[model samples]
Target: HSLHCQHPNTNFCILTRPNTHTHTHSMVDCHILLYIFPGQGAINPALQFAKHLIRMGVKVTIVTTVFAHRRITAPIPEVLTIVAFSDGYDEGFKLGDHDAQHFASELRSHGSRAIAELITASINEEGQGHPITHLVYTMGQTWAAEVARGLHIPSTPLWIQPATVFHIYYYYFNGYGDMIRKHTTTDPSCPIEIPGLPLLLTSRDLPSLLVPSNSNSYSFALPAFKEQLEYLLDTETNPPKVLVNTFDAIEPVALRAIEKFNLIPIGPLVPPPSLDRKDYAEWLNSKPESSVVYVSFGSFVVLSKQQMEEIARGLLESRLPFMWVIRETEEIGDKLEELEQGGIVVPWCSQVDVLSHPSLGCFVSHCGWNSSLESLVSGVPMVGFPQFTDQTTNAKLIEDVWKTGVRVTPNEEGIVNGDEIKRCIEMVMGGEEFTRNAKKWKALASKAVKEGGSLDMNLKAFVDEL
Candidate 1:
C-alpha cells in the first residue's frame, strides 16, 4: 500500500492498495507490512527503522499512544506513516505516581484492541488493503507481543536498553527473583552475582525495577517486566528473536549471555538531525568548540526543588557556559537571575542537535540509554546523575565498565549536592582520559552503523528474515 500524506500531523494516513476485485490470497503478505509499537522515552527508535524500511520498499506504520504522538518535537518524515491510538491515558502517563499495574492493564486492553483494529483495517479491501507481515514491539510495551501472539502473527520484541539489562531481567524472572529481592532488601547497595554477567552489581547498580519494598517503597513495574520476559522465554514455541539497540562489539558478552534467544544488535538507532539548521545554530556558534556543557534528563524524571537548586548552583560553580533542560514545572526561585550569568535554561531542545554541536564539551545526564548512546556517538563525556529505572545501571557502566564518565554520589540525605555535581563536571571536562575514551567509543559506534558493519548486518539480517 502506498501512503498519501493528505495533511500534516494527521493521526490517519491515507493508504492506497488494489480494489476489492483485485485483492487475493497472494496480496496477503505481498505488501511486506511492518507494524511497530513504541514506548515513550527520548525519541522513538521505531521511527529510525521506519525510515530504513520505507527505503527498503516495506509498508511501515507506527502505532503509539496519542500522548506520545503529540509529544514528538520534530516534524514527522514524509516517507514514513504513523497511526496513533488510545492507551487510556491520553494526557500522558505520570511515571513516579501512576499505578504501574493499572497503567499496564489499561495499556494492554486499549492498545491490544487498537492494534487489532489497525491491522485489520489495513488488510481489508474496503480499507487500506495491506496485510501486515510482521510486528515489532519496543521496550515497556510487552502487551504488544501478547496481542501479536493471539493473532498468530510473527512478532519481535525490541530491547531498547543495553543487552546486559535484558540478561538481568531474564535471570530475575527465571530463578533469581527471590534471592535478589532478599539481598537488596537488606542492603540497597549490596553486591550480588548474576549468571553470564562479569561485573558484581550492587543494588545501586541494579535496575530500579528489581529494588524490593521498603522505605524506598515498592516498584510497580516488576509485574509488567516479568510478563515481558516470561513471554519471551516461555510462551514462544521456537527461540524468540530479540532486537537490541546496541552494537555487537560493545556488548558481545551480554548479547551472547542468553543462549535460548536470538539477540540481534542493530543500533545506535539515533536519527539524523530533524531540527531547523538555524534553530540552535546561533547558540552553538556563540560558544567555543568543546566548551559547553549540555544537560538533560530525558522526557520524564522530574527532580526536586532542592536537586534543581543544587544542579543550578553546580553549573554556576563550574563557571562554564552550559545549556540545561529543566522541565517548566520546577521553579528555580531567585537562582533564575543568577543562572543567566553562566547559561540558558530552556524547557527542552533538540538533544541530538545539541550533542552533535561542536560546542558541546560534556554532558550532565541522567544516563537514560538513549542519552547515553547519544553522548557516546557524539563523543561527549558525561557527569552521570541517575535517578531511577535502568539509569543507575547505565551510569554504573558509564563510570566503571565503559569509563566514559563519572557517576555522581549523593550525600547521606540522598541528595546529590551542588558541590558534588561541580566536582564531577570539572573532572569530566578537565580530564583527558575520559575525553579520549569517549572519542574512541564514538568512532566504534560510527563504524558499527556504517555499511556492512556489525549493526548494519544485524539489521539487514532481521529485515531479510521477515
Candidate 2:
C-alpha cells in the first residue's frame, strides 16, 4: 500500500503505519469502494451492486462528488457508507454553462486524489473496520483505476452500458475508428461491419460519442472511452476484471468479443422497488391493464422545442392513457395542461415502479441502458427515441438483437414528428409478437438474477476471485 498527501482546499489526505497483517482472498477480508459519476442511471446500479456485496459480508463504500451526494434523496442500505469529496464544483456543474472537458479534468484530478486519500485512511486505521481491499468503479471514471494502481489494490470497472458498447469503443480506439468515422461522416445510414460483432451495424447505430457530428457537443466522451481502454491494455499483468450490468444469455456475442479481457456478466444490477412507490402504485392500479404508455427521457437530454411539441402532439393523437415525465414543463409551453387531462405529467416519478405496473403497455424512452434493462425485466415493449451517448446503440440492440421493441426514425429535420411517434406507439401496443418477446426476455432476466441463478453464482465467483 501507499501513502496519501494533503493538498490545499478541501482535502483530508491522511497517512499512518498500516497494520502489518497478511491477508487472504476471503469475503471477510474484502472491503470494496465504488466511485460513481453524478448520474442517476449509474448510481442506481452501483447502489444495487453494493447491496449485493454487502449481503455477501463484504464492506462497501460509495464515493461521489459533493454535488451528487447532496442530491441523493432516497434511503440507501444501513451498513453501506457513502463518502463525498469535491469535484471543484461543490454545488453543481451545468453542462450548458461550462465546458465538458474542464469538468471532466477536474473530476479526474480531484476524484483521484480524494479516492487515494480514502484508501489510505482505510489502510492505516486498524479500527476503521477493514482496508478497502478492492476498488470497483463505473464508466467514464478511468481515473479511479489509477489510484488502485498506485496503492497496489485490486480494481475492476463496472460497465453500466451493454457489453456491445464496450466492444464498439474498444475497436474505435484500437485502429478501427477511422473506418467508422469515414462512413459516419459520409452517410450515417450506410451499412458497416465491426470485426467482433456478428450483427450488421450502421454508422447510425454507433454510440453518439463516437460520431463525428457530435464531436463539438460530446467532446469529452470519446477521449475518456479511449483512455479507459488504453489503461486496461497498458496493464501488463493482473488486468482488472471487467464487470458488465448485463447477463450472458442476452449479450453472448459482445461479452466474449475481446480476447484480451474477461468480461464478467454479474448483472441486470436493477435495484429493488423504492420506498415511495405507494402513490404511483395507486395511480397505475386505477388504469386498465395494458392501457398506458409511459414516456420519459432520462435526466440529461434536453429536447428541442420542436421535438417536445411533436411528442406532445403525438401523445394527444394516440389517445392512449400515458404517464409522461417532463421535468421542465415550462419549456413545452401550455401543452402540459392538455396532456394532463388525457394522461399524467410529473417532474419526477419512480421508473421501476412505473415499468412494473400492469397498466403500462408501451414505453416511449430515450433508450438509456438503465431504462432499457428496467423495461426488459418488466416485460414492457418500447418505442425507442434515443437522444445521445450510448443510447442509439442500446436502441439498436433493443430492436434488432433483443427483438423487444421498435426504434423510431426522425424525419428530414431530425424531429421525430407526431405521426411517427403515434405510429410506433400504436405498432408496439398492438403487436402480440412484441409483447411475447418482451415477456420472454423478462423471464430470462429474472432467471439470471434470481437466487442460485447465473448472476448470483457470478457474483459469488467474483468475490472468490477477489
Candidate 3:
C-alpha cells in the first residue's frame, strides 16, 4: 500500500507502494528560482525575502556566484537552498574591499554563460517533476534575464538601490545623454529636474556617473554602468517587472514618479529572526536603551589613511560608547590604537541583531540602501558621512527630506575632520530636535511594514500577479 501525507504547511512527502499498489493522483508543485547579484549588502535582504516566501509554502532556490556565498558571512536563514556557480575567480587574491565588485565584474564576463548552462542543467535535473514557475533576478546580474527567457518563465528585476537611481538611468537611456552630461559637468551647484520624478534633486544627489566631469571616480565606472543600463532598457524578449527595496513612507515621491514605468515597491524586507548569536545578544541587552552608536560603511568604499585616523580621533573625542564594524580595509593607525583602548572594533558583526538591540541609539553610516533600511526599521537615527555612489543621494534624503540625520562636510581631500564627526555624532545621539524628528520617521516606518501596510499589500499583489 502507498501512503501520501501532507504537512500542516502543505509540504508533501510521498511513499511508494509496497506491492500490487493502485494508481494515485500525482503530487507536485511549482518552484521559484532566485538569481542574485554578488554585490555587497545584496544577499542578506534577498535571503530574507526567500525565507519569507518559503514559509508561505513556496519552494525557493538561490543561484549566485561562489565568491559571494563565501565572503558574505551573514548566516543563511533555514528553509532556503542556495545554488552557487563557479566564476573561476580565486578568493585567495586579497583585494580588500574590492572583492565584491571584482567578483561581480568577473561573473558578468564569464559567469553569465555558466549561469545559463546551470539553469538548463537544474531544469533537466528536475525533469518531469516540479518545474520553475518564476525567475527573480537582481539588477547586478542582468544576464539572468537571458536564462529566464530560454526557460520561458516570467522574470522580475530586484533593485537593491533607491528608485531614484533607476529613474536617473532610465532618463539616460531615453536620449537625454547630452543634457545629463552637460548638467553633470557644467553645474555641480545646479539642481537637475528629472522629467518623470516628482521631487527636484540636485546634481550632487545623482550617481557620480551621471555627472559630466571626467575627474571624478564615476568617470571611469560610467562606461561599464552605461553598458549595463543599455542592456536593461532593450526590450527584445520578455520584459521583466522592476522591484525596489524601499517603502512608500520613506520615499513616496520617488515611488509615485516611477509608477508609470511599472515598478513595484516591496521592502523594508529585513529578516524577522535574530542573528544566531546568543552571547552577543546578552552583551547588547546588558546596556540601556539609546546608549550605544553603531558604525559601519557598506562594504566597497574605503577611506584613506589620513581619513581613518581623523575618524578614530573623533570617536574618542566624543567619548561615547560605540560599536564599529571596521571593514578589512580600515587600517588602525596611531589614532585608532588610542581609541581601541576605550572601544570595540570588529571586522564584521551581526548587523540586524546589533541594530535591533536596545543599546543602539544611533547609526554612523555610508547610507547604503540595505543599511539605511535596517536602521530605519530599528528606529535608529543616522549621522550620514557618505563616501560615494548612491550614498550621497541617500545622505541627502536622510538629512534633508527625512530630517532624521545631519551631514558632515568633508575636507579638500574628501576626508571629514574630527570636529565635524564629533558634532554630527552628538547631534544624532542626543540633540532634542534631531531625536524628535528621528522618532517621527521611526513611527512612519513601523506603520509602513506592519500587517495591511502599504509594503505588505504591494508585496501580496506582486505575488498574485506572478
Candidate 4:
C-alpha cells in the first residue's frame, strides 16, 4: 500500500511508492532524472521552473551553495530535493573584499569537484542510486556545465536576463569588443548600435561588466562571464541549448539572433504569489485601484545616502500614495517620518503580492531582470531608475522596446532629483497608453506559461530529447 500527498499550491504530488512498484498511472510515472544547477539571484526562478518539471513527471534535484540555501524565502515543493555545496564562502561572500577574484577561482575549483561528486554519489549503489540524465545550469557558473560534460551527461545553460542583453554580451566578446571598449572609454554617453538589436544602446544601457563605473565592485567577474560564452562555443556538433527568461512575442528578434545556439525562451519564471497573507495586506487593501506606486531596488544594489535622500524627496513631492522598501542599514532620519505620513515603509513584503494588487498602478524600480519580469506579468507601469549592471539594459527595453513604462534620467550631478522622479511618476501613472501596453504584455506573458504555449512546448521538447 502507498500514500500520496499533494501540495495545495503547486500541482506536483509526493508519492511514497516502493521502488519495485512501478505503475503507469502514478505521479512518478516518468523515470527521467534532472539535475539543476543555479546561481544566487537565479536560484529562486530556477526552483520554480524545477517544480514544473516535477509536475511533468521528471525527477528533479537542485544543487546550489549554502548561502543560497539560506537565502531562499519561498516554500519548497514536497517532491523536489535540494543539496547544498560549498562555494568556499560558507559564511557568505561580502562586497569590497580583496578575495573577490580569489573567491571566483575558489568557487570554480571547489564547486566543480562538489558537483562531480554529487552526480557520482547519486548513481553509486551505496547512495540514492538514481541515474541523472540531464543537467541544467544558470549563468556565471560555467564550471557546472563542464562537470556535466565530463560525466557525459547532457546539459544546457539558463540565461537569466532579457534576450537582448544576451545578444549584447554575445556581440561584445565576438567581434565588437574593441569598438564597445573604445566607446565606453572615450565617452559613455555616445549611442552605439549592435548588429541584431534595433535600439541604439548608450554606455548607460550596456551591462556594467563591459564598461564598469568606479563604483562597480564586481568587475572581476567579467572574465567568468566571458568564459561561460567560450564554453558554449566549445560544443561543436549540436547548437548549445540556451534557456532564456523571456517570451516569443516580447523578444522574438533577440532570441533568434544567434544562429549557433538554440535560445529557448522558458520564463517570466517568478512563482505565483502565496495565499498566506502578510502584514502589509490590510494597508494595501486600504488603497483604491491603480492609485499606489510601489518602490523597491531589490535585495542587492545599496543606494548611496545622497541618492536615498533624493528619492525620499521625490516620493514626498509626488504626493502619490506609495510603498517604499528600504534596507535596515539605510537611514534617512527625520524624513522617514514625513514620508510615512503619506505612504508605508517596510524592509520587505511579498513583491509579487504587492505588484499583483489592484492598488499598484506604477513601479519605481531599479530595473533588475527579475523585477522587470514581475512588473510585466503584473501589468503595472514603471518609472525606471536603473542603477547598475543589466538594469540599464532592462530600463531601455521597458521604455523603448516594450513601451510599458518611462525611464528616469539623472541630472548632470548624477542624481535623479525629486522633481524628475515626480515628473516620471506622473507620466507613467497619468497616461492610459502605458497602462494599456502593460496589460497587453501581461496577457502575452501569461499566455506563454499556460499549457500548450511556447514556453511549455519548448520545455517539453528539451526534456523529451534527453
Best by TM-score: 2
Better-scoring candidate (TM-score), 2 or 4: 2
Q: On residues 313-402, what C-alpha lDDT tens digit does candidate 3 reach at each position?
A: 788889987778787757866655666665677787777788888788889998888888887777788998876677877888888877
Index of the highest-lDDT prediction: 2
Worst 10 residues of 2 by lDDT: 14-23
**Which residue pairs of candidate 4 clash?**
none
RMSD of each: 4.6, 4.6, 7.0, 5.3
Ranking by TM-score: 2, 4, 1, 3
Better of 1 and 4 by lDDT: 4
lDDT (10s digit) by residue, model 1, range 201-309? 9888888878754333236566666777777777777778888888876788999988888888888888765557755578778999999998898877778889889
Predicted candidate 4 versus true structure: per-residue lDDT over 421-447, tens digit per residue: 989999999999999999999999999
lDDT of 2 by residue, 72-119 (tens): 666665656777777778867766888778888898898888788888
Ranking by lDDT: 2, 4, 1, 3
Which 10 successive residues of model 4 have the least lDDT summed? Answer: 8-17
Against the hidden reference, what TM-scores do the models get? 0.89, 0.92, 0.83, 0.91
